[model samples]
Target: MKGKLLIFLIILILTTVPAIGADISGNVISESGKLAGLIVDLSKINGTESDENSITGVTYDFIPVASTVTGYEGEFVFENLDNGEYRVNVTYEGVTSGENIRLQDDTFVEFNLSGTIDGYVFKYNSTIDGVPVYLYDFYGIPAGNTTSGNNGTYSFGNIAAGKNYFVSAVYAEVSYTNNVTAPASSDFIVYDTTDKSDNIGVTIDHIVLSKDANSILVYEYIQFINNGDRVFFSPERTWLAIPTPRDISNFQTDVMECCLEREEDTAWIDPMIPLMPGETYSTEISYRFNPTSEPVFFNRITMYNTDYISILSEKINGLGLESTFSESNIVNVNDKEFEVLDFMNIPAGMTPDVKITGFVPSKNTGSDLGILLPLLLLLSAGALSYPFVRKKMLLKKKKVFTVKYNPDNPSGENGVPSGGNSEITALGINAENHTSGKTVEEMSFHELLAERNNLFESIMGLENEFNSGNVSEQEYMAQKKERRDSAVLVIKQLKDTATNLDLTQPVPELEEVIRHIDDIDILEKLFEREEKGMDRNEVKELIEDRIEDIERSE
Candidate 1:
């Protein structure tokens, strides 16, 4: 009896346990024909009964039951899977792909992975890592997204090939987009936002509003400064929003030194050029709007925080209007008091409203031809006399030579003198002995100045050639070394002459030359490695090091 009871208990335990069901197998291959050697997981999905308090149309994922690695042939298999629906997932190279599988019986599954899109995000010619990059299909559906790497490289996989898609990079609440097509392997693209505020610095120079006979003309001068170490290329391709206060017919968009586009009340400017570091881009825009016979209110919308703002009207008294600005000063212009607004340091992203109230001549008002005749005569006379006045002023001013022993002007003129329209002539040398040829010790002050100027000119020419890509780095360095040697010799001679003459304090003229020589010496050392030819990354690193050195010295 005991043996039979024990056997019955064992049979009952065996019957209660469930049995394994179907086996599922599949092979995963990328569109580029790359085999996937990754983990493939399977999760069993179970249906739940509807409850009164439960929410509807919600998906719940259960834990994965079994997982396996793909073989060399990109093949994966799961044995003893239950006869129910399961979620199959494959993860490879940090990318995940999945599908649904119903294992009613032993089945074979095949997955052809989609293509990939990969590229870099750049700002001011440098990579911006850790930025979020998104991918969307032609229908604007989010396909995939990824974050950039330290090198600013990002990739999105498992996207269908031969499809149109758009890529967007987001940084600092600004986005840049580009459209691309997925190739068999991958679609490579770049999204650059160098013209954005964070990458390019901006300042509002001034906003001037003047009265026109029939309407009011508004003028805005804004400056865009490039503070990045490298040049900000693609100026005209960069888009900046400018909101206009007037209607389409009343507004006029003028892009100076950049590209401009107007749509509705907003204007877009793309300064289509490479904006080098320390370079400034000035943009001017103007518009006109008609006024009413009754008191009319005019508002000049401040798109960006402006450093200086002003409003002037020649017919202020006639218009019977008072102009006011936030934190501004009053100044007299052509016998008329105009509001001048100046902000010493306006924080970025601040937009202040400017208000003006005046009674303008409406369509019902009669023409004041009697009052206008004298005004027209005065304007014509001023225009005709401008040239004579300018000439007299020019004649009275002394000729100023810019080629003093100073730093590089950054204007690409090198040491060449500018602005003075006077003829170039040889001046007297400051030496006690004015001989055509003399030793360094016997050289006069004027001779030293001339020699230093020539050296700087040569250096500047070499740099210009390099910048224009007309001269190779090797050639630039070779010529630079020769010029540097000559400059150093000239500087030493000047110092000795000062000491021999027993002069006290620093030499006023040679001070700038000495300082420039020191800077050149440091630059030579920094660029020594570049003589062998370095890539952009290496050059960027060198620049960073130089910046660090300068900061440390300060």
Candidate 2:
């Protein structure tokens, strides 16, 4: 019984669910921004259109048309229908237009359309210029043509469709007069050009243009090439910038600078200049200016051609662009001496490019003198001077040429030695260095004592020189440390190996060891195979190892 009750309740709830539908609405308006009363007819194919008055707020609800639903006021819809293709035609009165579709099940569909028409009307005769011929519709869409200047050309753009329209024309009217008011009523003559025609060609609408008795037609224009002519100037792009006069009251024409603006970083590149077909660079001086009394000056500008002022909106600030004015430059790579002439600033309105040739160098003519008097100077100095100058240059080069020579001992072919070998060899040992004359290792105490004293005196001398600061810190430290180390070591060795305390020892002659260690030739050969730049640590290690090798040999 519980299972049967649950089944019955589920079926009842399913059947009782409410149905959902789509809502759509819209309005029909004219180009002139006015209310438009329209008739909206919704229909499926093979069915008659059911019409409704769309005059009130141009809105409507979705209503069923056959099995599908359609909007009532340019607004249409589908409520709860299965997916299928359906076409709709929008119409005001009998004039029907484009279509929309309902493509899926449970989908909402809405759409609208109107015909847009525009064209030009050329009158065969060319008597008057600047006349306006226009069309007005009760639906508020306005369009039509105007008179061509003496050439008999006129055009109308941005037209709209759907409704009755009346055409009229007015002669001697101002250009682009969209307001169709009193002048149009009196001077314009209306014509019945079209009634239901959706697409039509240009139609002639006649009108009159009246001038006040005291007024005369003022004509304004100046014609020239891309660059300015002699009479006008390229106007300044701005009124003023920094390093410029604030009031243009003292001058006549606008000043101008031409440049290309870049979007990123807000930067601009002047001389975004292009070379012309004649290999001449052309610039335009377009400025909007009133009539001025004083002649426009192109003193600040450089390019030569200046004519009557031409007006254009876009501009940049005081950037002077360089062109191929001449193939000469007084300023060299590092010349900073330059001055602005008093006549550089342009007046309030003038703009032009004046070409300047023959740059003048303000400095005395030493460079010219160099070229002209070269023979005389050479004769006086002669070839012998080359050697002296060369030697001086070489001396200068020696400072940086350090890898090739240690300045502390430029005379040496080798570096300093540890001197252990001198002490050992002098004791008459046959330590296999058979070249030297000494022969025995077992020396008498007197001989070793005399040698130890010699080494001590030499070390003392080196230490004294180090304290006096006569030598550089590097040289003094190296020499004093080497001597002190060798002296102490040899002194102990001589004491132990000696046979008598009373006997004198010979001086430890370290000249040969020092000479061998300072050998630059051997060093140059080693450095040839080594990397070009030896860092401090590497140099230190190399010297230390060489010293150890000489000491061990002793």
Candidate 3:
């Protein structure tokens, strides 16, 4: 009976206990820096409801749990409450920061309201005020708009923290957009100045030009320096715009120096290579254009804050070609001379013209004195030997010229074959003619570039012929292989010459061929074949024979 009574008392005591409760307290601060007198609302999230039309594709239902106002210190708190989910909301001047949270036990939370967004709008070197600045959410919905101040600065004090925004503005009839991230406090978020023609820090360092029979090629090296503390790049749109001449063809961009992406005429340098403060980026770009016999005028567009501009042409220096420039101050680059145009520091509100007049070198002149010295000596010798040559010609005409020696007929003469003299003479003439032509190493810069271009064209033509069924598979592969081999040799020679001359460029087609010219043994054989002056077909046959021998030996 006593044990039963004790069990009953234990059950009665358990029934008289109270349920556990929790509390949530936190401080609410304004991100706009207006700390005091801000409304802080705490509400219990009753349940979640899925609504496709909601801002975030979902909506929440809540009931008012507690409300308070921030003091001068921007602080607030809530007393004991049941352990459950709660929503925190802060509103000041129609701007709000609200989010849901779960309250368990004595939870402490710090609520950060909206933050301030301020930045400057720039067009090149000049700052433009009175321009309307618009802000958009990540969904592209319009958030707020304001006009820039007298100093070209605009601010939005109540921007939600931890959110991305698209900032846009219109100036000089062009619309510009930038992607920006709001910081996590009331601190000022300064967006980088929009890249303008004046604000582009990239300056043309030097330009190397080559004038050939059909086209003019340019190798341009440019440098980009970031002066501001912030990195220069645009996430939403292109920040750097590299302009090209009108009707430019065969344009190529090499980012091995400074990685960038090229889109036809414009090369986007920034984004791929963010120009950080106190850092500089350098890149080399190349392109070619065909000009008529008439003089062709070319202009390189310049941005603000230019340091120096230079143009060098071997043909111009060699042939003493007649060329003109807007500015004339000759300069030396890489130990090579160049006609330079000085802009030291382009003044603000001034767009100086960077025009260059170029033309094909005249055939009457030689590229160097070495070529002219031989011609002059020959002329002088010819003038002095005119009488002796006339007498010799008369004697030869009077003498009976008969085929006394024949190299082909060994039995026709006494010991010496008949026509042996004529055969010797023919061989001498052939040797002299062969020596007059330019070798691969002796070719001019223009000729070397032209040969490379021709090889590229030949490779493409071979591909076309095979694709159109104009050639058999065997013939196509044979010709393609031979042409590709020749291209490899030419490309290597060009690259070596360019390196010695400090002429850097991007040749993707040649790079591809070099990549596939795999075997070191094959490369050595090709070099030997080139030394022997073998034709493409002959070299191809040699390579085939080598491959077959290797296979058989294996």
* Every model's TM-score: 0.30, 0.17, 0.29
- Candidate 2 residues 349-413, lDDT tens each? 22222222222222221221112122212212221111111111110111000112335554332
Q: Rank the candidates by TM-score, best first.
A: 1, 3, 2
- How many clashes in each structure? 4, 63, 8
Clashes of 2: 63
Which lDDT value does model 2 have at 63?
A: 38
Give the clashing residue pairs of candidate 1, or none: 235-271, 236-270, 236-271, 236-272
Quote the lDDT for 159 in model 3. Answer: 58
Cα-based lDDT at residue 269, candidate 3: 57
lDDT by residue for model 3 (1-554), tens: 99999999999999998765776666665544547777888889776443333222224567998888887777777776887778777765654555456667777766555666677876546666788877655433356778777877887766566666656675533335565667521112233434442344644445555544545665565666676645465444445555555645555564433546556445665444345455566655666644443555555444334544444454343322222223343322223344433333322222334433555624332222122222222222222112111111210111111234434675443322244223222100110001115666886544565565555545554565567688899998897787688668777776655434311111221232332332446545554543232122323343455445444434
| Residue 394 in model 3: lDDT | 12
Q: Is candidate 1 or candidate 3 better by TM-score?
A: 1
Question: Which candidate tops TM-score?
Answer: 1
Clashing pairs in 3: 124-198, 124-199, 125-198, 405-418, 405-419, 405-420, 406-418, 406-419
